[model samples]
Target: MVDNRYTITVGTEQFRFTRDQLESDPGNYFATYFFGEFTEASQGARELVIEKDIQLFRLIQAHLRGYDIFPLPDAAVPPYMTKEVAIKNLRHDAQFYCLGKLEGTIKDLEQTSVKKEVKNGGKSPLARRYKAGECVISSYLQTWTFQEINNDGYQLMLDKLKNIDIAIPSRRPQVPGFSVTFCWVKENYYYALLVSDD
Candidate 1:
C-alpha cells in the first residue's frame, strides 16, 4: 500500500488504487500502460477518466487485485447483466489492456461457463462444446436451421435441410448470438449437434 495513488474513473464509477498495487500485477494492461511512457488521459480532471461501462470495470479491478468477481453465480447469466457477462467483457478489456495472464484466466472461466450451461440449456458459442467426429442426436438439439441471429431468418441452413426430404420439423426461435450451426442427419432425423464454427 504505497502512499502514491490514483483513481481510474470509468463512466460514472470511480476506482482507487495505489501505484504499488497496480505494479504488483506487472503484466496487466492498465499497470503496464499507465506506469509506462504511453499513458494517456481519458478525461481531464487530474484523474484517468475513461468512457466505458462501470459495472464491468469493477470486475477488471477484481482481477487486478488477484481475485475473481464474486456474489455472481455463473448459471442463468445473460448478456444484459454484468454477473453473467463480466468475465467475457473483462476478457475483452484485458485483451485491450494487453493483460495476458488475466486473459488466460478469463478464457478458462469461459470454457467452464460453457460446460456448465450445456446441462442447463444455455446456448452460447463459447459454451457450445462438441467435435466433428462425434454423432449428435436430437437430444442435443432439434434438426432445424437458423440464419442471421440478430434477425433470425431461415436461410441456407433451413433451405438445405428443407431439400433433404423429411418431416420439416417445427423449429423454435433461434438464439441471438450464434451465426452458424453444424448439423448432421442420422436415424432418419436431423440433429443440430454442433453449434457455431470452432
Candidate 2:
C-alpha cells in the first residue's frame, strides 16, 4: 500500500519522500545526490537502497520535516519512539548521512534538557549529565566528580580527564591549568576541573 514517490529502501523498511522534500536541503547527503541534476535520468534511479541503519534514516526524515527531530516537551512521543532513543539514533544517522547541520541541534537539545533539569530543582541522577562547557559553583559540586591533582605531568592529568564521565562539551572540556590548564575561578576557590574521578 505504498504511494508513488522517491522510494528509499533501508534494511527491511521503506520510506517515501517527494523529490522536493529530498532536495529541500542540498547540503545534506541525500539531497546533494539528487540536487542540481536530472535525478530522473541518473543511473539506476528509480529506487535508492541504503545499507546503513534504518532507525537513523527516520531521524533524517524528521529533521527535514521540522528542522529538528524532537517534539515539544509536553507532546507524546510517536509510536515506537521516545525522546532519548530518538536523539541517540539521530546522532548516528547524522554522522552516517553527513548531515553536519544536525550536530549543533543535538548539542543544543542536550544542553537545554540538562538546564531544564537543573532549574526544576537540580542534581540529575547521573553526574554524567554535566556537559562540557557548563560551570557550577561549589554548592552544586555534588553533581560532579572532581579529581585530585598528583605529581603527574599536565598532559597525563589531561588524558585522565578524558576518561572521566564528563559529557563532551560543544567545544570540549579543558582543564586549562597553569600546569592544570584551567576552567573557572570564584571567590577564593579555584578548580581546574569539574568532573568526578569516579
Please list the residue runs of candidate 2 whose C-alpha ends up more than 4 Å from where it truly belongs after superposition: 1-4, 36-44, 72-85, 124-198
Q: What is the lDDT of candidate 2?
A: 0.55
Instruction: Report the lDDT tens digits of candidate 1 across residue range 82-188.
Output: 34345556668878877777777777877777787787776664334332222224566544443223211223234456557644234423434433244555575
RMSD of each: 12.0, 13.8
Candidate 1 Cα deviation (angstroms), residue 138: 32
> Candidate 2: how large is its RMSD?
13.8
lDDT of each: 0.55, 0.55
Q: After superposition, how far is residue 22 of candidate 2 from its true place, in Å?
A: 1.1
On residues 43-65, what C-alpha lDDT tens digit does candidate 2 reach at each position? 53656678855666666776665
lDDT of 2 at 87: 66
